[model samples]
Target: MKTRAVRMYGEMDLRLEEFELPEIKDDEILVKVISDSICMSTYKLAKQGKKHKRAPQDIDVNPIITGHECSGVIVQVGEKWKDKYKVGDKWALQPALNYQGKLDSPGYSYRFCGGDATYCIMPHEVMELDALLPYDGEAFYQASLGEPMSCVIGGYHANYHTNKQNYNHAMGTKKDGNILIMGGCGPMGLGAVSYGIRFENKPKRIVVTDVDDAKLERAASVISPEFAASKGVELIYFNSSKENAEEELLALTDGHGYDDVFVYVPFKPVAEMGDRLLAFDGCMNFFAGPTDNQFKSEINLYNAHYTSTHILGTTGGNNDDLLEALQLAAKGEINPSVMVTHVGGLDAVADTTCNLPGIPGGKKLCYTQFDMPLTAIDDFEELGKKDELFAKLDESCKAHNGLWNPEAEKILFAHFNVEI
Candidate 1:
């Protein structure tokens, strides 16, 4: 079978290419990808073209597939996986496959068998050992959310603060605690907001700050009324670009300080703000993975010590976290689809990643099947007409209770095959 995937070979270069699938082994299974969400890691690799430390060397040398957060249905199950995962069963494919020495597991260690492809082969090591969520739900978003929710769960389990550097597992459960999520408008930050709000019956206040007001408003709408009312969680939006943003955060917490702060932005300024806003004994969770060599923040060490503030960072989640994330999504506790503001086919992924980060909106999802059907015009008059078309679409989105329309979808879809 031929599958579509984004291949990276050089800096700021990505191409949607098709590759031949290998025959499944007795201990493996073939899955047809249903939905996959674009992650920050994907964006980094697509633009930077740097070899990820965790990625296998072979993947770096060869053209590698770029998606990790995805969900699919089992189409062909080999003999060994027949009893465990039958054909026609929907499952969340774990991205991290630990192929110690054997053929690389799909969607795991090798960057080649990613979710961007139409079909991916999973070896027994990944099939039997990694997390698999049986999708008995109505939507595919639940399965797709497994990748991220699992990371949050792992972060929860990895102990935010400890006397011994690597031996503690103290999950945050303090009552009346407040969490400040920097860059809360992004998908990861929004997930943190959902987790901080919905986990347990504990009443917690979540304040999400971002530079873009539009993105902040979108996040606010998702957590409105029902989730906020039931969880006793208030989702407050703040503009971090403002001069007195830190002061604003202090005022919101009544000068006591935030109990936990999740830094979702990778820039240095955001990190500094997180360090400054933390209360005594508070834990600052660095959710964004900064560049490998980029030590972007200058922390106030004196304050960090005197106040006993804890700072921690985490990567992808383990198997347990992935399962829990799927379960939560299954229960409709978190709507992963709500984060999807834009959707296009495989060809649109490269341009979407390049431009969407600068756009003020939600996540952009790439569907591997459909090819966008739109024509491009170069005349100035035609360009003016195109601008009008987009304006009308934006108006329609706002008018229809905040839903994306067909025209906006077309515009986003058209940019996929643009010359890079």
Candidate 2:
């Protein structure tokens, strides 16, 4: 079949072109893409190119696609996968395809596969590992959001603290303890906040801190302090740009310290601040992936040793995490839709990804079949004055108080002449 995709040749080099996909082998499955959400990691990979660990090393001869967060429908099934996945079934892909420790992933490793493309082929490894998941949700974007949500869940699972009694250790977040999320206004941080507040282990309280009050306000509105309070979970948003922000947070915890801290940004000053604020037996998760190969920051190793405060970092989620994210979304425990802030089409992915860092918002969702440019929900009202399509989209989103929902997605796809 003739397919079109955005391929990455090198850093600052991405091209959207048409190519023919070879017939799939018996172990492969052909999928038609639905929705793809642009992740900040894709921006880092696009800029870093060959320097990225998960990205393929070869360039001029063998370029790869450039999107990991995506959703699709099974259009053709191989003989081997026929019983497991049939045509017309919705599916999601977990990008962390650790094939014998080889640094190969769908978007970064395969030329005929990527979330930003019109179509993608699920190769043998993806099927065998059960990474190509069957999705039962009505909203296709939920599948795309699954990958990132899984990363958040994995961070919480990977966190651990030493047991003072046995001098052994305990993994996962402190059960029924206080939790702090640094820079929690961002998309990923917001997911952590939502997941943390309703974690099965049940935290006693959660405080999300950020530098900008406006972002915090928006975060509060999205997550809703009132909702958290109604659920009997204390969710507080604090502006930490002030000089006394640390003191205020310490005071909130009665000067003891937070039980768990999830740091979303890797800035040296902020990272060091996160380090110093760790309590005895506290687990600090440096969740953000660093671009610099030699990234360094000061850590109080003396306190780390004496207080048993340990620091850990994670790159991405495994298959189990991805499944958990989907399961949670299915059960109404977590809403992946809370992360989306902007919607666009395939053509806008290149620009949207290149300017992702400068752009401030949550997840940017792209519909592969549409021809629209990148449009933020905040700008939908303004754009409605010119484009009637956006006018309807503006009203649809406004009906839900400016949030992405299944109805809005249906309106967009129908207006764009794509089957929902």
Candidate 3:
């Protein structure tokens, strides 16, 4: 079989080409990709290309497809995996290959096994780790959102609540305590907010901070303070660029510092601001990763010793977190759709991924089976009149308040002329 894939040939080079895939080995599984969500990390790797730590060593010999957050249906399962999986099974990917701590993963370094394609091969490491997981959900975003949602949960799990007095006090976010989400207007931030309010051990107050008021407003409409209040959680949106940003945040926390601060942007000043937002024994999660190796930020060590404030950072997520994300989503406890503001198809992903940083949305969901360009539902009203295909999508999303659901996905996929 031949798969059409967008491959990274070198720095600033990505090509969509058709290639004959090798026969599936006895231990391999072949699957057709469905929905995928573009991540900022993919943009980071795209710009850095061969220079990226997890990127292929030599693009000439090892060009790979990009993107890790995805879900798909198993079209053919290898004989070895047949007992555990079937041809019609659905799955999500953990996407982290901690193989002896080597930098190898599907989207970043595996050419034929990545998610940004019509189809792919599952490598030995993926099978060994059981990352291709069986799932039960209606929206493909459940599978696509699993990796990122796991990351949000993993960040919480990775934190440490300090009991030791002198050298260090605590780690992780305080359970049922005040929390701050820095740059919380983006896709990942929305997930963090959803998880924060809906978590069993919910916080007293969850503060979401951003520089853009419009984004803050839009976010408010999605995960409204009214909605959060129903769950006995206070959700507030603050524009950090304002003069009273810190004071306002502290005020929401009842004059005490935030017990947990999650920094969603990688800029030094934001990190610096996040450091200041930490309270005594507060744990800071630097969620957004910077590309530069020499990037440095000013941290308050005196406060670290005096107030026991410390910080922790992590990449991707582990397997268990994926399952937890799926379970929570299945129960309707958390809405992953809030993170997605745009939806398109495989043809749009290449361009959308390249210009992700500039694209103004939370998550850009892509359906691989269709041939549509990157299009945002917000613009549907303007474009719908010009095109009937978009007219249907706009109508569907309007009913859900600009959110994409299984129905919207089905409507959009049905517009495709050919069967996939």
Candidate 4:
């Protein structure tokens, strides 16, 4: 089969080319990728190439495909796994294969098996580790977003509280306790905020801090304070760039501090601020990853020993977290669409991945079968003046409170005469 994908040749060297894929083995499956959400980790991989720990060293010779967070329909099922999986089944990728204790993963180490392609092969190890998840969501984009949402869910699950009577640790955030999410307004941070308010063990209050007022306002417009209040949780947004930011943030909790604090930015000050805001026995999760190898932050050791404050970090989600995210999204309990602000085609993947940080907005979702530039949903109206397709899409999104939805995706595909 012939597949077109973005392949990384070296550091910042990605090419969008067409190649013939070898016939799938009996133990492997073939899929037609529909949607893929760009991730920061993929940007890091493009920057580091062979130097990335999870990336193969021989990318210069045999280039590897460049994407991971993806979802699609199964086109062909291998005979070895026909009983467990069949053609036309929708699947989301977990990507953390953890196969045989190696750093290798789908997007970074595979040649014919990655998300940024019209078609790709799913190796046997993907099913062996249960990394290829079955998805029944209404939209393919939601399934693609499940991977990032799982990371947010994993951060919450990784937090622990201690029992004074015993040495064991109680998993998960403190139920009905005060929670703080620092630097919360980006894509992943927004997912964390949504999960914080909607999770079964909802927090008493959630305080989100960010430097940008526009972003904070946009976040509130979607996941409003009223919405959180309906769920028996108080939601507040604070600007963290002020001179008295720390003092003002602490006052929001009535001086009791936060029981669960999440740092969504890798800046040292943000990490240190999260440390100071921890209540007695409070758990802090450093959710954002830093690109620098020598990144460091100061922690109050006295508080750690005397106040029972501690911190931990998580990079990816496990099978359980992925399943939870998918179920919640499918049930309409959580809206992963809030994280997607832009959409494009496979032709836009390389440029979008390379300049992801420079671009403003949340997730950039790519549809694999067409050729379109990366376009923001917020700009639909302006683009609509020139094209009627975008006009219909803009009207559809505006009807749904300006957020991307299944109807908008259908309109986009229908305009192109695509059957998806």
Candidate 5:
């Protein structure tokens, strides 16, 4: 099969080219990738290339395709797995396959198996680890976003508090407790806030803070306070950039502090602020991954000694978390569309992935079968004036509160005369 994908040849060297894919082995499967969500990790990989642990050292000689967060339809099933999986089944992938302690993964290590392609092969290891998950959602973008949402779920699951009687650790967030999410207006941070409000071990109140007023406004609009009230949770958006913001934020909790605090940005001040806002047995989660190896933040050790305040960190989610993400999305309990801000085609993957950090907004979603530039949903109306395709897309998205949805995806595919 011939596939067009963005492949990494060396450090900061990415190419969009067409190539023939070798036939899938009996233990492998073939899929027609529909949608992929660009991640910052892919930007890091493009910059680091062979130096990355998951990237093969011989990438210059043998390039690997570069997208990971994707969802698609099974086109061909290998004989070895025909009984387990069949053609025409929708699927989502959990890419963090720490298989047998090996660092290699789909998007970083495989030549013919990645998301930035019209078609790709799934190796046997993916099935062996059960990383290829069955998805029955109407929208493929939801499955593509499941990977990031799962990481948010994992962070929530990783939080733990201590039992005073035995000094034992209790898993998960405290139920009916006050929660704080710092620097929470970006894509992942928005996911954290959405999940916290709908989570089973629900928080009584969720306070989300961010430095940018625009981001805070967008986050509030996407995940409204009315929605939180309907879910029996109190939601508040605070601007951390304001003077005496910390003091003002604390006053909202009646000076009791928070039972659970999450740091969504790698900024040291935010981390330290989260530490100071901890309640007696509060569990603080550092959710953002920093590029610096020596990233440090000051912690209130006095609270750790006198109270039961502690901290932990999570980089990604496990398989169980991905499953939960998929289940919640399918059930309409959580809207993954809130994370998506831009839409593009496979032609835009390389450039978008290479400069992801420079672009402001949330997830950049791409469809693998067409050619279109990366355009923000917020700018759809302006772009629509020049092209009817974007006009229809703008109409569809605007009908859904300026968020990407199944109707918008359908409109896009229909414009390209491509069947989903």
Candidate 6:
């Protein structure tokens, strides 16, 4: 049997290739991938190539399939696993292979295969453990959102402010505390906003900041309206690129700063801004992961000491967090659909990851399979058209001034073919 996969050939180069599927062991099951969301971490590694710590260190380096967030139906269960997972059961797979007591999992530490393919083999331990959640969603994209949402839950449960003596504090379940979502236009950042507004009882004010006006507008249209007027949950947008970003944030908080600040961008400058905007007794959760060996920051120690500010970093999710994220997504408490700004099949992913990050707003989602075959195309051709296309898109975005609409999807999809 043949499978399609996105292979990382070198720095800034990933190609979709066809490969032969491995025979499944009796203790394993074969899953036909339904949908996959491109992870920011995966995009970073693909761009960095050899510099990535998680990249396999072996001869078989080229053609390494690259995807992590994925959901699929159990198509072929092995003999011993027949009773454990039925052939038609829909489920999501957590790419972390370390759940079986190994130091690392297949997708992360080695070239064990990933979800950007037509089919994958799940080990017994992965099927029974890790972040796999049963799926009953209306679309495959919703199911695939589990991984990103799970990571958010992990950050939420990291107990960021609860550990330090002076800085230890909680945002509580009430809506009185102020929460700032840094880089609020990205996928994880947007997810944090949804969680804060919907589950945290509509915080006093849910402030979202991003350099891109389009993304900030997108967040307001989709997330802000969910809160009731009485909750006093206001969605405010700030351009982090401005010289007065800190001053603006302080003004929003009545000069006190935000109670909880979630840092969703890995850029060093963004991190510093988060630390500066943190309110006294505030907890700054570094929700995004920096690249390997790329630490860059200069914080004010005096301010931290006097204000009792806290900083914390977290990555990957535990099983419990995944469960909560899945439940929240299942109930529509969190809307993953609003954040999906781009969608395509396997062939479009390499280009999607290469350019999506540079785009001004919204999460670019890649569909593993599509109802119709997308014409095969090259990345260079797509990149060549980006300048012209981006201009038109930007104009439309400015005219609406960040309104949420399905038209953005049409614009993005029109630029890329969606076949493998």
TM-score result, candidate 1: 0.81
Model 2 TM-score relative to the real fold: 0.97
Model 3 lDDT on a 0 to 1 scale: 0.84
Query: Which predicted model would earn the best TM-score?
Result: 4
Task: State the RMSD for candidate 6.
Answer: 6.0
Question: TM-scores of the models, in the given order?
Answer: 0.81, 0.97, 0.96, 0.99, 0.98, 0.81
Give model 5 RMSD, 1 decimal. 1.2
lDDT tens readout by residue for model 6, 300-393 = 7887788777787778776666667777877867766655665456777788776656654455566565422222111223433766655554
RMSD of each predicted structure: 6.1, 1.3, 1.9, 0.9, 1.2, 6.0
Which tens-of-lDDT digit does each residue in 1-420 have in candidate 2?
977788889887888788888999999999999889998888998889888877777864688878888888988999998888989899888988878878688887887788988887888999988989889987888889999999999998899877767866777899877788998888899899878877776677889988888889888888898888876788899998998988988888888788898989878877888888888888899987778878889999998879988898987899889999998988878878779899998898888888899988899999887667888899989989999878888898888757787888888877878763
* Lowest-sum lDDT 10-residue window in model 5: 161-170
Candidate 4, superposed: residue stretches over 4 Å from native: none
Model 4 over residues 1-420: C-alpha lDDT tens digits?
899999999999999999999999999999999989999999999998888888888999999998999999999988998999989999999997788898788889999999999999999999888888899888889999999999999999999999689999989899999999998999999999899988766899999999999999999998999999998999999999999998988898899999999999899999999999999999999999888888999999999999999999989999899999999998989889889899999999999999998999999999998889999999999999999988998999999888999998888788776554
lDDT: the better of candidates 3 and 4: 4
Compose the digit string of candidate 1's lDDT tens values, residues 344-407: 5667776666554664456666656555312221121344456764454456555534544334
Residue-wise C-alpha lDDT for candidate 5, range 1-420, written one tens digit per residue: 899998999988999999999988999999999999998889889988887879998999999998999999999999999999989999999999887889778889999999999999999989999999999988899999999999999999999888768967778899999999998898998999889988989999999998888998999999999999999999999998988988988898999899999898889999999999998999999988776768998999999989889999998788999999999988989888999999999999999998888999999999999999999998999988998988999999989988999999988888888765
Off by over 4 Å in 1: 56-61, 98-112, 157-169, 201-203, 225-227, 354-356, 373-420
lDDT of every model, 2 decimals: 0.66, 0.86, 0.84, 0.92, 0.91, 0.67
Indicate whether candidate 2 or candidate 3 has the larger TM-score: 2
How well is each residue in 1-420 modelled by candidate 3, as lDDT tens digits?
999877888776777778978888879899888878888888888989888988877886778987789998888888888788888788999998787678688889987887788899988779888888888888777789988999998887777667664656344467779888999989899999999887766788999989998999999989999999999899989998988777877877778888888989988988898899888788888988887888889999999989888888977788998999998998888888888888777888888888888889889888777667787779888998999877887888889877877787777667774233
What C-alpha lDDT, on a 0 to 100 scale, does residue 402 get in candidate 1?
Answer: 54
Alpha carbon lDDT at 385, candidate 6: 70
lDDT of 4 at 250: 87
